[model samples]
Target chain A: MAPIKNGRHLFNEVPVGYPVPGKTTVYDESETIDLETVPLNGGILIKALSFSIDPYMRGKMRAPTKKSYSPPYAIGEPLNNHAVGLVLRSENPSFKAGDHVWAFLPFQEYVVQTNVAHVKLLENKENIPWSNYVGAAGMPGQTAYLGWKIFSKAKKGETVFVTTGAGPVGSIVAQLAKLGGLKVIASAGSDEKVEFMKKIGVDVAFNYKTTDTVKVLEEHGPIDIYWDNVGGATLEAALDAANPYARFIECGMISQYNQTSPYGVKNLMNIVGKRLSINGFIVSDHMTPENAKDFYDTIPAMIAKGELVFLEDKKYGLDKVGEAILDVQSGKNHGKSVIVVAEE
Target chain B: MAPIKNGRHLFNEVPVGYPVPGKTTVYDESETIDLETVPLNGGILIKALSFSIDPYMRGKMRAPTKKSYSPPYAIGEPLNNHAVGLVLRSENPSFKAGDHVWAFLPFQEYVVQTNVAHVKLLENKENIPWSNYVGAAGMPGQTAYLGWKIFSKAKKGETVFVTTGAGPVGSIVAQLAKLGGLKVIASAGSDEKVEFMKKIGVDVAFNYKTTDTVKVLEEHGPIDIYWDNVGGATLEAALDAANPYARFIECGMISQYNQTSPYGVKNLMNIVGKRLSINGFIVSDHMTPENAKDFYDTIPAMIAKGELVFLEDKKYGLDKVGEAILDVQSGKNHGKSVIVVAEE
Candidate 1:
């Protein structure tokens, strides 16, 4: 086959606040790759299927000097995250042509995957949407599942408050808490997202933009658990409404990700008086083989049975990757933001 | 028996900042108690021995409308705290005359104790100082023990950073961490207190007043556990120095106790990236019969055997109660601040 155009989003500059679509990340289509003759070197060649754009990626677009759980995106390098791709050519036995695979893929249409260690073979036995693997059956889903399972310790009739309720992780956590016989109070930025929260059977859903977070919590909670996705003001409100021995699952803090000066949380003294347990975790740390197996064995089947539902904000093509990430960061994207590079 | 003057510290006013020694709390010796005729009502007549003046009491000096783990001190009432007393007479079968008893006692020279449920008989088998019962072997000791035991999850070779390292709770926690084979980094406000930390075998002791907290922690930490006694800025420094999955035992926040505006902790975002577990607790909550048994059985013996050591800042007489509490609130007290009303 002849050389083909390969479009990608490259880290152009370090962002001070919200990453600019063109400046922080530039869409470069000047690259070309020969599909049939590109050297695999005992590796697998993959055609990018879809990309999972998450709020955590915002933390990665920083100066390399700054340390975080995730590595910083180097200037002039392809910005990467959890992405699903179709294996087109295989020089390794583990991955064959036509097999779908998932890994931390760079934002590009075609890639030569030399490191197959972290790359996982996707088993879509339930035939869920290929993009769904990057959302509900993927990192965000496992995060919600393991975090809730391991940390929630939810008892019957207890209340849980989940922030960013319409997002993938928050939505799943809210649903799980509800299934575990909890009263779910959730918040979203927009009215539409709030409606989505209600549709998903959240007991109390509110638009944080218009409503006072503390008042809502005071009315609906003395929450037993807090699934904190957006930290800052929401976390303060959670602390105010927290019942004694409240468990706080600090999954993400999207609200502070882009701020030059992070929000100063004033009421953490409540953490002592209320005996609140605040646990911050990255899902990657808990992605043991046993946990991943359990997640895959249980979650995919639930999604297929329509018991666990997830919403996706689908953005077509690799060119839209920058916009998708920005949408996720700014809470413009209503659901799990996905960049579709090619049709399955 | 003849009538005796009962000097006490009464809550005269609710304070906004630091409680005024005479205004917020007034020294009252106006009431004379007839020791023989005063009705105990089928309870015990006790002579107050010593009072524990701790930072948590500052929180209780707030307006009654505010809620907390410990109830607020009502105006025109005697300010109470963990105290040791000698029972002069007893009608209850559980206690006898001349027995040393410990309970939450008012800062008075004499008292008629009717409620004996919460009161405990102090068995000073090792012949330890009676004031030590209200300091190390009392609530602060149990707090240090339980908070460290239940929350720390510390492993050998791990590092623990303790603030207020010379206080009753911090001192015990520091010693416990050291005994558990963890590297202990402790901070105190004064040079003398830092010297005490060094005496108690803290691996790295620093005067937070003279040396920078962040600088010291950076030099010796990446701490696995933080026994947080003084919250505010020190808590921020601990967060910065935290290793992944750091355990924060939020025992107290003396730094923010008297502040009109609580410190706005800016780097709580590090909580998520570092996968920190911050747990706040009141020692009373964990003082289950079983836990209390374990604590009394283990800790008192440790202190007696010289495996654990504690220091006390003894202020003589009921008139000094207000000053003692002031010393505690201001970090002026070198050790556990105790007001000695009478000798054992």
Candidate 2:
């Protein structure tokens, strides 16, 4: 396939409401995003299909502007997080054309940035659906592996409490913990999510909206690990229900994201008292360039072993980009939200 | 000095009011207080002169408290924190009679215990004031040393924000930072403290009670290392003023100790956004028997070299122990509070 000629870029925009406007805008002139352009220099160009719409992105749109696991998004600057794409062009000596890649990318059609280290320039893109690269095969996958393997140390028979049990990272983490032979207790926002979590190997799954977080966790008995994807009241409840020396792996705090003020986790003081280790981590921080080899091997092996089963909710066409980001931020999309930009 | 052989025991209590009826109940007993003889096990005899009444002691007062830097105090029993005294007798083989040890001792005159790892058996007391074993030359000294060196990686010309700057750890840490050639900005509660800090080597000292934390910090400009003693508002202010990639060493959060419901730091989001490293540490965690010698030697040199000056706020007698603890907790003690139990 040859490179497309320069043209206007299309993006999604939102009007004020429950759903940000699902409208599209076309720029009068094409912006040169090539790495070699201006003071910036990366001939690097990746055509993104799977961009992560994480809970942290919604935090950027907060009303009073609250602090988040990730910085709040400015009014509108093409929100970015994790993305798995194919390198269409490579200026760096390390990368080659047609290479599969995963990097922190924007909710846009293309990304051409220099010095994006956490981004993995993948060698094999076969058998594994490109979508999984953003889901079970990609960052959400790594978030689970590193968090459970390193931070949480989710051991066999240990109980894990995971918030947002049906979402991307939380879902994978729950599955991984279960695979590691740990008992999983999870909190979801909706009944459907609860059922989905249970179906995917959670021992105890509850809709936090319908159940008292503390009461549900209490009924679940003792928990040794808390995977915090939803970090407001559930985090507090988990803290109250934790056994001594519990590990709370803070993947992201979706519950408190868009609120101008923080969603208070009153039991945070328990961190010091119980000798609990509550570590807030950006999954990218855990990944090294070499981790990609494990990724290329594990995703396929997990699939063959019937270990990892993941889902994707795709919003197609570049025009739907804004709506996709909105859906991603609001956490309305089930599983991972990926944008299909000129799908191959 | 002659030892008492009264064959009688006295449980004398002095009241303090911070976390609770803050009291130090000294044991004036001639009867064996050994763990085998007492109602409980694991007891050793301690001849106490100075007991450390630290900020962490407040956490122990609560029944089901958060994870702590120090061990929790048992209910209805004598509490232990950092202490300096002689071992009168011991069931624990690591200790013996007339051994001048420094421990996180019980708030008693004599402590007979089985848990000796809880105590740091002293080989050298150096004929220094017993209070120094718990104050400037002790835990606070180590706290400052470790917090600066370990967590903050304190460097020259970099700005440092130290709250409760007139207190033991803060004062010692400030001078140490000065010796390391860093730009030090301190915040305390009063004018007298401001002057004392200025006299003993603080480039900028603001009275937190008088000046605004945010404004004062901004006026001082970018802070690279924040040695937070007063958590809550001062911590929030420090967070607001910190430079990108700044390090926050949480040595103590004394400001929130007295609050029944602890306050949330409004600007804590800065930790993630700025990529700041905010670490909570108890200096005791960094010390060992081998390093304790080095720590002891270093302080004496700095003091003798006039590179460090220790400020002592003397309380008249052992009975004034209650007042000294209260004064320190309330920030009324301008410097290190020394209980003049016996004259050197």
Please write out the lDDT profile of model 1 over residues A230-301, one tens digit for every residue. Answer: 898888889899998999999888888888888888888999999989899889899999999999999999
Instruction: Let me know the TM-score candidate 1 reaches against the reference structure.
Output: 0.97
TM-score of each: 0.97, 0.79
**Location of the lowest summed lDDT over 10 successive residues in candidate 2 chain B:** B6-15
lDDT of 2 by residue, B1-344 (tens): 33443221112332234622223433333344442243324446666666655666555555445344455555445555676777666666677777777776555555555677767765443455567777777787888876676677777789998788888888988888888898999988899999988987899998888788889888996799888777776777787788866877766667666666777644444544465655556666668766667788777556556677777787654445555666777888867775544332
Report DockQ per prediction, comma-separated.
Answer: 0.87, 0.16
Per-residue alpha-carbon lDDT of candidate 2 for residues A197-271, written as tens digits (9 for 90 to 100): 988989889887778888878788578988877666666778788876687676666555455577544444454
